[model samples]
Target: MSDCYELFLTCPKSLEGLLVEEATQLGLQEVREQVAVVRGQGDLETAYRLCLWSRLANRVLLVLARFPVQNAEDLYQGVLAVDWHDHLMSSGSLAVEFSGHGSGIDNTHFGALKVKDAVVDKLRTADGVRPSIDKVNPDLRIHLRLEKGEAILSLDLAGHSLHQRGYRLQQGAAPLKENLAAAILIRAGWPRIAAEGGALADPMCGVGTFLVEAAMMAADMAPNLKRERWGFSNWLGHVPALWKKLHEEARARADAGLAKPPLWIRGYEGDPRLIQPGRNNIERAGLGDWVKIYQGELATFEPRPDQNQKGLVVSNPPYGERLGDEASLLYLYQNLGERLRQACLGWEAAVFTGAPELGKRMGIRSHKQYAFWNGALACKLLLLKVLPEQFVTGERRAAGDESRSAPQNEPARLSEGGQMFANRLQKNLKQLGKWARKEGIQCYRLYDADMPEYALAIDLYGDRVHVQEYAPPRSIDPEKAQARLLDALAAIPQALDVDPANVVVKRRERQSGTRQYERQGSEGRFLEVVEGGVKLLVNLTDYLDTGLFLDHRPMRMRIQREAAGKRFLNLFCYTATASVHAAKGGARSTTSVDLSKTYLDWARRNLSLNGFSDKHKLQQGDVMAWLAEDRGEYDMIFIDPPTFSNSKRMEGVFDVQRDQVQLLDLAMARLAPGGVLYFSNNFRKFELDEGLAARYAVTEISAETIDPDFARNTKIHRAWRLATR
Candidate 1:
């Protein structure tokens, strides 16, 4: 073996800078970074030092030979040229790891087999014995990389990758890789913080990877000290005496470092199953006394009074893969931001996430951001110094004329496409402003898909703006959609002259069954606005549907005008906004029926807000079931069912399109002799069946219900009036 040789240190992508810095610090010369590999010149002892101390390296490969080869025969010949007997004994087992493919070596498995065959054939010819292939635990590990007819053969001195530090016996779901975790700590400046005796925390720690790594760094403990198996153990090229001396020195240093006073390293996890694994990992790393993990939710994680007040809080929360409902996760992000602002006053916050759109929900300004990869998924690491000046402009401002805050989340320098959207919003607002002002409407739709490229519905609820983006089709490029969304968000604050904090955004897609009624979050924050002279509470963040339906404003107003001295019935009366208007119109009595208890509670609050107490009634049950059981007659009725429902309380699935006839017949049976029933639905493709229209006097009133705010989108909903002949 040569005294000095070429060493290739492999680490996770985006961490090459840290590894280069580390190698340079360790006295390795000519260190250069390329993707995930760092090339350097070092002696055997320098390689040994890296294997023992590198917290960021996945493997240390010693380059043995390089050649130009093509096809399996050429590859076999090239690998055979290396003197195999000098590395390992002929009787020992070996493992070959092949990466990349070119010039007829199209697959990794085939290329690795060729290299293995060549090595075995050479050893057999030299010593009359062949080394057996051992994939699980090999005596010698070989690495081969082929690219564009060029081959580089190397010996993997670190087996099973240096990342397998032997501390993590169990793992939680989506555990951050150990090396990547170390890279995050290094990038977040944990070394400086540790030197100053400041604290470190991972609120969403998975199996204590960050906690263990942080403690190891603070105490100067070698990362691979606890590992039992290594490729160099049985290699003939390894110097036994030198390795022994280095190993002993590492053990002594680790022991002394472990004895230092702990720098507060703590973690918090909501999952109880993850807590034990985190504790177990810390203990296995010989850091039981230095690192601690407790069970807690993200919203309630706060630094203890006994702990360091100013430090860093870093976490890897879920990235929202879009397979299931994401409403709760949005609230999770929003609440996380709120908690960080409330509790972590002077600390630093670092959040790593794969879904950058979900990151926008946090509402906190990131002063610095770095891009990294978790396997194949592209991710972002956002860093923010939690202080008043660092907060996103207009994040928590309370004012009437809130002049445009900084572009929502630092939008890309105003593009011409963004300027076009700004002009469209201004035109729509001016067109609707006179009508809205004359009618005394405090809440109205300002723009509705006015531009096809920007598929959004912008609504004004007094001072707050609610933006709903329709999910784009699969054929659209994701980056393009994201750019368009950012452009639209950037244009909103400037066009409407409102604060960005007052803007709440949500993605709207076709709902499956009862998912539309599912709770997105529980912020419990409400804004009271007037619609047709009735006071109602609207929540923009908690659920998919705001409490009041702006499209049905004209219908609610008509109910108020026509229900004088008449008994009124509101079916599927979500929040009872229409029923409140009826009560204000001197209805003899009003009854509201719905299947959700939450909406029933909201309905009660709305009635209480308007001083209409005993005469108005709220019924919580399946509206169809309630209609079938009701025996009383009413002079006026409104039946508006959801497009589809699979609620557990319902006897069976309910589809408005398929069951409208039976539903109308049931309501007609309960109608007084001269009473009228109004039916409405939001199914865009709904067509009224002809048989029911022939049986009764049915009038399509969809056009009459279109108000000025919703006139641009004529297909918003369809309405009908029916009465017995």
Candidate 2:
């Protein structure tokens, strides 16, 4: 046996460059970067050192063979060609692991079985015994990977995924993996910089991944110090005395730095629910003295001053997409910007943002940007430099702007010399709207949401943005301007962001109607709109009204094409456009049901506009209530329901999560034998109810059903086509 073996390391994303650096530091050779992984070679000592020191890689594997195979027979011959006696025992258990990317083999398990057969059969012929496959935790684990028509075989040197670092006892919503966290810290320069007293903070510290990692790196701690066991301990080539010495040495090194002056590390989150668990994690890591937890909103925060050097501020704020839509998150971002300017000057900050448009609200240009993954969603970590001049600007404000506009998180402005600046801002926002479309950004707004006085606004919806503004600041009195703003707002509708309803504006505190019509919307007493050769009333006075859903415009166009020849069943059928599509496509009949009589009326108007008045059937009743009555069949159906809602008139509550199974089953019952069910919801976490795979062909047609404009809203709803095989 050789004293050295060529080892290959599989590094996780964001950890690649750091892994190669660490491997070099530990005296390994031939390091290289791959897609989300790093590969290198070393001896047994190198493998052992990596197992203990690799903060970025999940595990290390020993390369066995690199070969080309065209079919299952070739796969068997290749696997059998390996010297099985060198790595596996006749009686030992073994498991075949597999990964395929752009490979001809469609079934991963089939490839794994072929390899397993080759190894076991070869060993059986040589020693009259064969290793059995043990999936849970095999002593001799073999991994097979096929990518781009070539196959790679390797022996797993580390058991488990290596992310179970033994310290994470408590998990919050979407806690990041340990390796990923370590990589991000090192990549952010936490190791080299935190040592120089650049104190760190994660204000919205979700379970303290940043804080914990920063503390560990500050103490020169290894990321995998808490791991209970590793694959090398059981390998026959292991030198027991050497591993023991290394373990003892590592523990001594860690203890040597244990009593050093506590790092000025702190993390704060207002949620009392998170504090106890966060403390639990801190104590678990033996870092209680180094990290502090606080409870409060960022609105009132004061950074600890240090005369030595600027500090570091890093936060992963909730993207508008995290809670729901972009329109709901502008104020949060605005407030974040205000707090940072007011409280965190003289600090380098990294705002790990998934929404670049929202990042613009911070009003500070990012000095650098790093791309990384936060779960499946790709994110941009924006590095911002908080200059010393920021607070100076906030202090020298002029008079007459009693808005006391929270400047820390607001766009910069000058009251006396405002015309040039406002024009620049307006122009930037307009340009941002065009850029957002080209880049296909999701949920980035061009304007701040709480700017109640603006006559027009645009939400860019994400990173692809160019910005501009309109008009100049006039010398009107604050009170008069406020009155005009109120006049502008007093006329819009309740469903402001959705539906084809007109906008209405009404005062919040007025005792009676000053304009005679108290309930009619903002500007629609005599408005008429002609759309698709049909004349319809349009109201832009209220909060919402005056046009169709701009986003769903393409969906309507889709309906007009597909509705002609099929009868339709529209569930939760708001305005019944799908029914219109089915009718226009030459469908025999259309039945639309909804709890809203107003919507049922609107559905009729839509059908009449398309000249399907005779074929259109509108039913104003609770969908849940009417489902059990054995309603008539249709060739096409549309099922769209509110995520969390109740139809009080129907004598029961209808919540999507708790009631999806019954509703989907009901929709299935209403469908014709060969019909397609178009089910959708805006709730991102909605799951298709289980156990109906035997009854119908349920294909998640969400991607296919969504119009071109709504591409990023993949989780908005799931559609299914159902039919017996």
Candidate 3:
């Protein structure tokens, strides 16, 4: 026997040359090479040799069954004919793994399921006992492939995906699997270079996979020598004698090939998440005693030991995929490139990136660019060798595919959503008087209110902020909610009297049920008003309410003192503070109106808490529509409508900023000549349409209206005192 055995070696695309070297190094003759795969004849001894030696190959597969099968029926028949019971015990468990083909099969998962069913069905019929199926791990892992319409069934020799490499106890977002890491090292010619005293590294060493892979290759250990078993071990015709000899020989060879000082390998990770996993992987690869893990920003990094020099530096930087901003990721790569020039000299650096912009950032031309697929992500592995002269100067000169970094003095542009939120929140903070502070108040304002997503907060006092989250309103422009939030923040200061910086606005991340994130804009607040020997410091600004509603700010304060020994009326009293003030000031009676049953109940509670009657009239009806049909008289009236109001009960659109004149005119017609009307609006640019001021005593009281907490701006509310002529 010439020791002829079937051999199949898999390589990541673009690394064919490296795989060829690995195969030849294993003493396996390559009778055939097909694109990403190399197939040849080898004995059981040669198979073990390749398993112990090859670093570039994903896995060395041993073909168990090759059939020109087409449909599901053919698949079932071919699987049934295999002498499965010869190697597998009746008590053994099996897992079916599959890949390749779309037109011939609906999907890989479905194809794999069909293959599993066929294998188990065959065993049950022929041997009278079928093995159990294990998805996680199993005694035998069967691999079925339908490629280019040809179905080939092979035993997965590496139990866990070859990527397991027995390393990495942790990981980062979208980490590179271990086998792929080793493949890149071999593909980059690291083994050949390492054998000659060259070095290797990964600057963006996510979980240290590439560095660990390089270390393992440098150690001269078979990638799978640590692995326990393969799918073929349980196959019908498996040669126990040959496999045992091959396994032992591989161990002996690996033991003999150990280097004295170990190849110079380094793995650098800027993210903390990758460090632990990287450490675990290095230890698992039996290289933990050799490799070092570091956590720091790539740009400000200094080499741990200045002595190690002139090897390979590989980095997989940001790719602008499912991450923060695209500009942030780009800046990260740009700074990374600068580091390569400033710190890494007389050395070769390989950058594996999904973003090609990385090569441009390095400011150095790549000698070789290898294209590889990092999980359906088309990526390029760029290689740059720093020559001796270039290394000494340690300065970058821009050339093809490279450029200068962004100038520090240049203006920064924010996303529209971010800008709107920041701008509006700042403006509102400037005018507010009351602040939600942790020491005095507890809930301090968090976000100023800008973001496409909805989140509004009123800091109650520290640790507790009343939070309100609203969705985008239909029938309005998409930016309406955002615009309203800005408007709300701007007007809040006049209503409360707080510094602009004190109010913070943050957008809430939408999530299901209890997992959602909410605002803590204002958690602690100490500002409290005293009336009738009672103290009031609870923050109404931390939630959706921005403390004092500027529209009602003047009205609340007016009613606070004026309602003493007088009748008071509050229409659409959301927080019912005005009605409470009336009762606190010793008013004879009070009435409140709102469509919300929840708020109406709240208004009744407000009156009762202030020693006023719960018997005070509370109407759950549209204010505009209800007042149109009925008449009620009061000694003093405070009517302030929102700039834009739409209710579930009315078809009319109420625009207080624009419709204040007509709205006030109606109130005046119902008012007694001496009965005063306090009218207000929150529209900052509000200008009273001419004739109204002439008809009534309309004095602009905006300047006189403000509280200490809302000191951000005085113009947050527009107020007027009107008495009929």
Candidate 4:
């Protein structure tokens, strides 16, 4: 056997450079870096040490053979050329993993099959006795990489990925892999901070990955000290004495490190469910004395370490995967920045996030950024020095003014145009506030593009503000439009006397199909607002439209006024706001139908919120299909459909202009005698079918449905009342 063997250390992308440095420091010779891998030459003891010590590597492979191959036969021949008996016994089991493609092997499964056949055939005896395939715990795990028509075969020294540190059996929805977490800590300078006897904290720690990893590093403990098995454990070349020596040395070092006073490492998770699991993980890692976890919210997260000790604050906050999540996440990052400024002065901070744009919203300048891949998603690690100088308090007016160092949560100073916009908002609020207060309305439209340059519709739900910026015209410069939007956003909180963190912003564009009903966020946060004596749920952060339609307030009120002792039917009910109003107004029963199960579930919540679930029915199906099968008659009905929809659940596309007659006729069939059916749509160019007037008594009620709040935009929605002729 060769005294030295070529080794390939595989890691996550962008860690190859760090792995090369680490491998060299671990006594590897001729170390070189490659994409997602580092290559070096090491002896048996060196290989074993690397496996036990590497913090960034995912796998440690010992190259067995390298040969040129051009076809499947060539691949088989190349793998068979290696002496299998020296590595595996005839009674042992083996597994083969093949990566890359070409050499006439397009499918990875087929490539793996060929490699397995070669090993089995070579190990077969005259009596056909050979090794069996055992994927889970193989005596020999072979890896073949076919690249550029050359095949490189190796033995996987680590049975599974090294990232499975064995301490984290339970994790949160999205947990960072231990190796990735280690790399982040290294980049954040956690090692140096720990070496200096500094403390560490993770405010938004999910399952305590960062806390455990930091504790292990600080205590000079080998990450894989607790692992029981490896790919080479059962191999014939395995040296038990050498491995035992390394293990004992590692244990002694860990024991000695633990003998000293442990560094303070704490984690705070907002979810109560994760608290016990995090404590279990820390205990399993034998870091109980060094690390502690508590259930705490981000708003109240304050880490107290020993006096006169400064450290690193590291966290991997959720970046969100849904569409509208960015808007809500903006506030989370803002809060994190605020907390850092308030509590962690003179400390360093590392924030890992998939949304770099949202990270920029933290209002703290990141001195450096490192790019990483969390699985397939590209992410950034923003490193910040939480000093007063890094706080972004807008532009400095003159030097060293006390006002210039204002906190990030403070309302930003307005520009000339912003002041003008703020003045307009004040004027509109003064006029609308009185009317809304007198009408007992807690939610109303405060501004609807009052200034064309701003092009935003600001709605007030209780004390929270929902701002929708109309997509700028193609002729408008995007940069200028963005500046104008900033101006308007800055003006909103100041003018409305609300906190800056209470504002949520989203861009509004012409939606097609069922896009409007699609979930934009997953926060599931709902605000209760009262309108027309009904308590309704409004999720300003999770959808393009809040649950309660501000423009439809008058229509809902009209429905309530006429709903006494009548059966009510609401189609395209959204979150069933209208149905709630009807039920509140003493409707005998209410049935609401929509295509979204999410919305129906939300409707159920809204109905339950108002203590009206018993007589209320929430149906989840295509409204057209539901209406066709529904045989019960309704005394009063209201339908407000989208401008256009191509939902997959529906049979075909629905165009308000083309399908209006058919929709109205189908709905009219369910309308009982003397019943009134109110139909409305927001299609700007919609003209009522003239034939409906002849078929039934149809009266245009568009004028009466427009409330004083939506008076500026009279065409918000056109309404009609129809009955049997």
- The candidate maximizing lDDT is 4
Ranking by TM-score: 4, 1, 2, 3
Q: Tens digits of per-residue lDDT for model 1 on 1-725?
A: 67888999999888899899998887689998999899989999998899988988999998898899867899999999998889988899999999998889889999999999999988885447789989989999999989888998999889888888999989986888888988888888888888888888887887899889889988988899888778798888998899889889999988888888888888999999888888988889989889899999886777652543478888888866432224345556665666666667677888888866656656577888889888888998888776656655244534332232322333223457878999988898888877889889889999888888888888999988888888999988978887687768767777888766677888889998878778987788988888777789999888878898899998999999988888899999999998999988889999999999999999999999989879899999988888889998999999888999998999999998899998999898888889999999999989898898888899999999999888889999999999999
Per-residue lDDT of 135-180 in model 3, one digit per residue for the tens? 8768787888787667788766655555555556677877776666
lDDT of 2 by residue, 381-494 (tens): 777776533232335334332222345433332232233334433654456546545644333333332243443333221221211122225664645443333222221111
TM-scores of the models, in the order given: 0.65, 0.58, 0.57, 0.85
RMSD of candidates 1 onward, in order: 9.4, 18.0, 11.2, 4.7
Name the best candidate (by TM-score).
4
lDDT of 3 at 60: 72
Give the per-residue lDDT digits (tens) of candidate 4, residues 417-522.
9799999999999999999898898998888987889899989998998988899999999878866876676677779898766888887899988777777877
Q: Which parts of model 2 have CA positions greater than 4 angstroms off?
A: 101-104, 123-130, 305-310, 322-324, 389-725
**Candidates' C-alpha lDDT:** 0.84, 0.63, 0.62, 0.87
Cα-lDDT of candidate 3: 0.62
Candidate 3, run of 10 with poorest lDDT: 511-520
Clash count, predicted structure 3? 80
RMSD of 1: 9.4
Worst 10 residues of 1 by lDDT: 399-408
C-alpha lDDT of residue 125 in model 2 = 51
